[model samples]
Target: MLNWSAKRPVIAAVAAILALSACGSGDDSGATGKKDSDGVITVKLGVVGPKTGPASLYYKYMDQNFETFSDDFEEKYKVRFEIIGEDDQASPEETARAVSRLINEEAVHAILGPPLSGNALQVADVIQKSQIPWLLAGPNADEAINYDIQPNWAFQTNFTNQQIMEILGTRLFADNNKVGIVYSADGFGQSNLDHLKSWAKENGKKLTAEESLQPGSSDANAIIKRFKSAGVDSVFMGITQGADTATVTRAIEQAGYEPKTIMTTGTILTNYKTIAEPSQWENIQIVDPRNFLEGGDKEILDAVQEATGEAPAIPTNNISTYAMLDIYAQAVAEVGDANDREAVRKAMEDIETVHIGSLTIEKPFTTTDHKLYDDDPANWLTYGFDEKFNLKLLGTAEECLEKGC
Candidate 1:
C-alpha cells in the first residue's frame, strides 16, 4: 500500500476528497439499421450519471464493466450492440436532457441509470412519460414509486424505504429511542432521509433530530455537532460519495457522539478509513449487500486493474454499475435480439440469475419480481474496513435483519 501519511503533505484537503460525489455511454453509427439477420438484435442503450464531479472518478470503474459487457455480449450472441452515450456531469436537468437524447436522438430503448436517486427521479419521469420500460440499477428513492409520478414501467433491484426499515430497523433496533438523521440539503439526500424516517417511525422510532450540511462541506464536524445536540443514538446519514464516510466518521468524533452503529443505505464501504484514525474504524458499520472485491474476483478484478494499469480505489457504487452492464448484456442475449425495445426490457426484467465475480443476482429482476435480492436479509451482507482501505466482510444481512427500531 502506498503510504499516504508520509506522502501526505499538509494540504488543505485530499485532492480525491475534493472530487464531487453522487453520481454515463456510446453511439453505434450503424445502430439505425443494424438489426440482427436471423432475428432482430443490436440494442441501443443510454447510461447516465455525473461523470465529472467529486464522484466523477467512479466513471472509470463502472465504464470497465460496461465495455466488457458490451464486447462479451456482442461476441457470444453474434448480436451487435448499438450501445451508445454517457452523461456523467449530474443534473436532473442534464439527466432529462440525456434521456431525451437517448430516446429521441440515439433511439435507445432501455436506460441503465442516472446514478443518484434524485437524478433517477427526473430521468425515470421522462422515460415513463415516453412509455419506455426502464429497469433501474441505481437509486433507491421510495418516493419515485409512491409519489405517483413514477409509472409501473420504472423499477429497481431492491425494496422501498419501508422495506429498508423493515430489514435494517429490525437489526438496528433502538428501544424507546428516536433515530438520528443527517443529510445534505440536496434533493437526493433528502429523498433517502425521508424514506428512512418514514420507515423508522413505523417501527416506533421517532426522528429525534434532523440536520443538513451545506453542499460541498466534506468535513462533517459541524453537522455532527448538531446531531449530537439532538441526542441521536443512531444515525441515518445520506452522502453522495463513499469517501464521505471518513468525513462523517470524523464529524462523529468531533461531536463526541459514537452511537452503537451507523447505517447508510446505498452507501459503499470503500472509504470508511478516511474519516478518522484506523483504530476507530471498528466503531463504523456498513449495511453493504455484496462481498467486496479487494483483490478477489479474479476475472473482473484483474481486468479492472489491467484496464487502469493499476488498482485504483474501487468506488462503493462500482459493483452496481458493473452488474448493471452485465445484466443488460445478459438480457439482450437471453432475448436473442437487442433490437426489440420491449423485448430488451422483458429480458432485463427476467434477469433471475447472474454468473459473475463474487456477487450474484441469485434472484435477479423479473417481470413479476422486480426486487433483486430476496426479501431475505440473509442475501445482503454487511462490510467494514481493515487497517488499510481493503473491504472486510462483516456479516450477512440475515444476521441483522429486524422489525423494530
Candidate 2:
C-alpha cells in the first residue's frame, strides 16, 4: 500500500497552487483551432503530468521535449504551436482538474499525457465527454481504455502490460518456469501483476512466490527472504520507482541469493551502480521500448539539445514523446485544420503502417483498439548492462523467445 501520509498534503498544496496559477489572467473563452491572421494555423496542445511529485523525473523528461517538438512542428508545417502544461503533482484529482482546464479553458487541439495510470483513469470521462484526441504517453496500463471510456479518441504510445508480460513470459518460460514476482502495491504494479498472471496461466507456468511493496519503501529484506525460501530460479520485478529497484536489489544481494532477475523499464537508473553491488547487477534484464544502444533519432536529439541547451542522458522517454507528437503532427497535417478534433481523430485512426522515429507501427490506431502495439514483440526489447556498466541489447522480443537469454 502507498504511504499517503506525506504525499497527500503535498498533492493538496500543489493542486491549490496550480489551480490559482491556471485560473489567473487567462482568456476564459475556451476557443480552439484558431487560425492566425497571417494564415498560420495555431494549434494549442495540452500536456498534463506530475512535474513536482515522486514520479517527477519521468514527466520532467517528457516536459523538456515539448518546446523542441513545438519549434520543429512550426518550422516544418509553418504552423504556430502553443503548449499549455499543467502539473498534476501525480494526483488523480489534480489530473482531472488539469485536463478540465486544458479542454474547457485553454481549448487544446490535442492532449499529450497524464503519465500515471490512476491520473489517466480519473480524466477518462472528461476526455470522452470533450471528444479531445488524447495520447497517453506513459503508464503502460491496458485497462485505462476499458474503463467505460471511449477508445476511439484515446490512444497510447507505450506498450501495454499484456504486451510486456507476453515477451517476459516467453523468455522466462523457455529457460526456467519456477518464477517469483515482486511488485509495487499500486495501480501500475497491479496492472503488471494481473498481466503476468494471465500470461503465466496461458503459458502453463505457475508462480512460486509473489510479493508487493510500496514505492520508495526500503524494507525489501522480508520479500527477498520469501523468494529465497520459495527456491525460485527467476525473479520478475514490477516495481517502477528507481529507489525501490535499488532497495530490492540490495536486499536480494544481502540475502545471498542471485537468480536471473527481470525488471520492467524505469528500474534501470544511473544510481544503481552505486546503490547495488557490482556482482548483484549482473545477469539482470530490463524490458523496455527503446534500445539504448541503438541511439534513437539523432535529428530529434539534436533539436532537443539545441532548444533546451542540454540533452537528456537517458533519451527513451524523450524519443517516445517525440514519436507520439510526430503521429499527432501527421494527423494534423493531413486534416489541414487543427481545430477539428474529430477530423484529427479520424486521421489518426486511418494511419496504417508508418515509421515514426526508430519505432514502426502497423495500423497503430483504430476506433475500438486504442492500443498501438498489441502482441507485437518487435515493439519491445530486452537490455542488460555489459561489464563496463553500459547498456547492451540482449535481444528483440522474438529473439528472446526463440533463444533463451
Candidate 3:
C-alpha cells in the first residue's frame, strides 16, 4: 500500500501541480542542442550551489566529489561529463540566472539545484521548455511545486520541509515534550514554521515558542530568553548552514537554556559541523540521507577519500549529490540518443533499482513519480554526534534502513 494521506505534506502546490496534469504536448520553443561527436557520449549536467558564497568551502568539496563522479562515469560508461558548475553565491536570483545560463547557453542535458529551494525556485520554466530532465536535490518548501513551472522531466530527491516536521513529530512521541523552533524568517524558515505548527496540532504536542531570526543575523539572545521562559527542553531549527545553526546554539547556551535535544534540516546538515565550533556540535542532532561513500563498503569511495583527504561523506548532501550523478549516468546508458528527448526520458522513467555494490535504494523512479524514497530521508532519521563524536540516531534511522520498516 502507498500509505499516503490527504494531510500529508504537499509536493507541488494544489493549483500548479493540477496544471501539470494538463501539460499536454502544447506549442513549445526548444533548444537546438549540439550533438556529442567522435563516438564519445559527451553530456553535461548543470550544477548550481554556493561555490563562492558562505557555503563555498563545502561546495568546493562537492566539486571535488563531482570530479570523482566524472572520472568514475568515464571509466564505466565511456562518456565524458562536462560539468558546468555555476556559483550562485547562495542567492536565489543568482541561482535562477545561473540555471538560465547553464541550460540556454551551456546546453546541458539536465539542471541540478542550489541545495536550497529558496535559491532555485525560479528556473523550472526554462527547464520545462527545454525538455531536459532536471534531477534536483535541495530545499523542500513546496516552492518548486508552486514555482509556476513544472517540467515533465523534473524529479526531486530531497523531501519537503513539512516532511522534516513529520520526522520530528515521530521523535516527540518518545522521551520529550515541547519543541522550540528557531527559524531564519525568510521563505525557508517561514515554510518550516508552517510545518512545525501543523505537526504540533495534529499530534497533540505543545510548541514552547517559535523564534524567527533575520537572514544572516547572529543575535538570538531575545529568542533564547523566550525558549527559556517556555521551558522548552528540546529544539527544532530550520535554516541553512552558516551562522544560523551556530548562533542559535550559542544563544541558547548564553541565555542559560539547555535543550534536551535539537532537530535540524538538510540545510544545516550540509555544512554545519565544518563551520560551527566543535563544542557547539555536542549532542546536536541533524537529519541526514544515506551517503554510503563514507563507509568501508566500496573501493570507489575509498579511492575518493584517499585522493580528497576528506572523510568521503558522513552521509548528507554529498551522498545525494553523488547519487544524482549515478541517476544521470544510468539514464544515458538506458535510452539517451544524440538528438532525441523521448529516449532519454524513457531511460529515466525506466530506472528500477540502482545497487552500486553496497549503496542502494529500494524501488527507484518510474513514469509517475520522481522521488527516491518510499518516504523521504527527512522521514527517516535525526542523526548527529554526541560530545564524544559518536553518531546518535534519535528517530527511525536504524529501524528503517537495517531492520526494514
Clashing pairs in 3: 233-260
RMSD after CA superposition, every candidate: 8.0, 7.6, 10.5
Clashes of 1: 23
- State the TM-score for model 3: 0.78
Go through the candidates in order and give the clash count of each: 23, 0, 1
Local accuracy of candidate 2 as per-residue lDDT tens digits, 269-385: 523555566666677787766655544445555556665576552355566676677677767777778878888888887876544444466776666776666676776677777
Candidate 1 wrong stretches, greater than 4 Å: 1-28, 32-41, 80-83, 133-135, 145-151, 158-163, 175-178, 265-276, 293-302, 310-316, 358-363, 366-369, 400-405
**Reference-based lDDT, each prediction:** 0.57, 0.68, 0.60
Q: Write the per-residue lDDT of candidate 1 for residues 1-405, one digit (tens) a residue.
A: 111121222221211121112111234334442444655455555566667767554455445444333344444444444444465476678778877877786667677676667777776556777766565655666655433542256656434444565566655555555567667666557866776677766766667777775555677777777777766777766665556656776667766677766776545443444545875555555565455544323445555555444453454345555555566666776766555556666666666766455445565654454555444677567666677745566667775444321
Evaluated against the true structure, the overall lDDT of model 1 is 0.57
Cα TM-score per model? 0.78, 0.85, 0.78
Expressed as tens digits, the lDDT of each residue in 287-321 for candidate 3 is: 55443224422444454455456654423445555
